[model samples]
Target: MTRNVARNRSPFSIWLAVISLCTAGLVGTYVLFVEAPPPRRIVIATGGKDGAYYRFAQLYANLLKSEGITLEVRSTQGSVENLKLLMDDDSDVRVAFVQTGIANSEQCDSLEALASLYREPLWIFYRGSKGIDRLTQLKQQRIAIGPEGSGTRGIALQLLKANGLGEKDDEFSALAGNLAAEALERGEIDVAFFVAGVDAKYVRKLLRDPEIHLAELTHAEAYERQFRFLSAVKIDEGLLDLQQNIPSHQIVLIAPAATLVAHRSLHPALVSLLLKVATKVHQQGDLLSNVGEFPSPKLTDLPLNPEAERYFRSGPPVLQRFMPFWLASMLDRLKIMIIPLIMLLMPLMRVAPPLVRWQTRRKIYLWYAELRRIDLRSIDGMTIEEADSSLEHLHRLEQQIARIGVPLSYMEEYYNLRLHLNLVRSRVLSILRGEAGHSQPGSHPGFRTEGGESTLAR
Candidate 1:
């Protein structure tokens, strides 16, 4: 009884070994060939100290870390420097929040956009002896265009040049936004030109002071015409507040839209995830964007990524909308795995049955060959005595096949092959007993006669 139990377990043990090897091969294939998760740490190129970009980057850093992403918000001069960092692979920076119209045309090839966060209104406040309402009035005064390589400086230069003014015509100072505002308050700088989002701390402080007036762009329409990138917007009276009743009249401003730019090599999954986070962060009903409307890819030098463009047009994918954040992220990483899994499973399901039958029937088919050999030898003008001996050999072959063991899994195909062997045996016996005619002229009982030959013999 113990010997029989060991014999039964031998096949199971062999199959277990085969399945173990197959499982190992499958796991190794998935690990080596499937898509990998994104880098754990990333750098977010932002602006210098005390700027709007730097503050926003801090918020972004906090938000990303919650999603298992480490963000290094590196401070620099501003937009131009941010673009440079993303374009240089040696820096290992992947993303940047850049202002539009400040980037060089050549740098655009290395960088594209993920989203445009908000519009950066250029707020030029001047505390001069003369009351100035237009940019043309600052032609000869010492004006601070913002720090060198800063987004403010880049926009300041263009706005001045648009109004038929240049650094040669006016004295230009390269100072940070807060520094410029303090200098203008101290009566050191004649005018301060700041390009930043609304609610910039230094700008708010300057707005409350009675000594300084927010310079309105009287030539806003003309400026927008000259520089197509500039948008003319009006700051309505008491728009900042209802109680202060400040700016009793409307203030016109010329501004450029701030865009979110990154390297073209950024992963598509990361872009999708970033856009999902940005939608939550920026789509609120604030002074900048309306509810359910933000993080747009509408304005940028480089074209939007194909997947991002599709997502913006349609909305978040189904898995993202319903699944938890981390699960959705894992599903995004496993996007390519779906294809390989289907490819692996579908064929196994279709061909396993036939494959198992072919493997198990090897010994059964060997007996059929022995029966055929004996029938051929007896057909060489043998007497009835020789024919009876051949019939005995055929019977023994059939008994051996009937006694062979087959597992339950392959029982159907195993029985079908046996049925075919039985049919062949019956026809061979009838021919030997002279109950059926062998014909080269027509189809025979044992096999079809094609081209004057049996199909099996041929």
Candidate 2:
């Protein structure tokens, strides 16, 4: 009996599976193309662990960690190497700290600036007897301009070229950090160019050295004019160490802002979050910048990301301002798909009722096609052998229909179909008995066999 019912609904079940697959396919396509979730992990390229970029990146990492994101701060040579990592298509690095004016025109199309982080003052320390107030005063002296693929080297060359100095490899050295400081003390190098924060170790070492004098750059505003990325920042007297009375007097210096940058394909959610992080990390008052001044859009050379631009113009996302970052991001990613999902569901809702009705009635009405086929052929004047065969087919069909189970709502259809099938069976039996009324067919619903007083009907 169970096998008979399984045979009845087998076609309907196959159709159901096909429709289910099609529906699943549509939703999968929507998720894969229209509205996908952002990655939970991100990679950021920064300078060496001792540099300001890596330190700032760690602060950013801590804040992002609270939001369920893993920010990997990968240390590199410097901004030049960081930019290369971001530009490489196969590289997983998406975010990095880049100095203003470090990216060239050809590379500008692939990257975007989130915000200007902080001022990295260009500190030039020389071992000469008299303080060299201007860049042109030092001629053919050994200069430590940092290593290749370092932002310090890029900026040092630009500054040196601007001062009417030639770029000869023999004239310049790649020494940096302790090497540059030690070389200066041993007179191996006459000058060392460094772009770093006040907290950097090398910058601090040079500042405390009495023999190495800081070059008082003349025409600080003129350098800012020549390089759009440069800004004139003032160092107040004893700002680094007030207890030791360092700097002796206040002096103006040219500086470049370290900008937080990302590739063009980085997720917008991350960009918005990073903007919020920049506010918390760099908005506080520092030595060179007042409160809320460091992360400003000023002094940034790369084109601003759309999300970052909006964030600076307004504020953090409305959802993020009040709720937890993870929850807020989830809601934002789903908001776009809400309408599309509703649109996809509407068709399924409409077609479901008719499809269900067909499946239910199919369980009962299926016998009708076979019942009608047997009744049409079993007519008056048929041979006894044909009449017995037709009657046998009708009995088999009636047995098959009896085993089918349907919902309570469809029980009425089930019983009515049984009645039609019975009438057809009675006609075939009456024909087999050769009754008087067996000459003509009946007129009941789904019954078109002979109208005869059947022995079974009796």
| Number of the top TM-score candidate | 2
* Candidate 2 weakest ten by summed lDDT: 440-449
True-structure Cα RMSD, model 2: 6.5
Over 4 Å off, model 2? 1-4, 10-21, 27-45, 57-76, 84-95, 127-131, 140-142, 168-171, 185-189, 263-285, 291-296, 306-344, 370-394, 425-458
Q: Pick the candidate with the highest lDDT.
A: 2
lDDT of 2 by residue, 1-458 (tens): 11266555643565576578656856675667555567899999998777788888999899999998999999998889988999999999999999887987565689988889889899999996797888887787888899887898989988888788877633888887778888998889999998888887777878887788899988899999999999899888998889988778998999988999899999998898998988899889578888988687778888889999998888898999999888888788767666756675677657767777888888787667776776677653556566666666667766777777788888999899889888887777666555424444432222344454323322
Q: For residues 28-56, could you state the per-residue lDDT of candidate 1 as single tens digits?
A: 76698766666667788888867777777
Residue 311 error for model 1, in Å? 2.3
- Output the lDDT of residue 235, model 2: 88
List TM-scores for all candidates, in order. 0.73, 0.75
Worst 10 residues of 1 by lDDT: 1-10
Error of 1 at 9 (Å): 11
* Superposed model 1: Cα runs more than 4 Å off: 1-36, 324-330, 333-347, 363-405, 408-458
Clashing pairs in 1: none
lDDT of each model, Cα atoms only? 0.71, 0.81
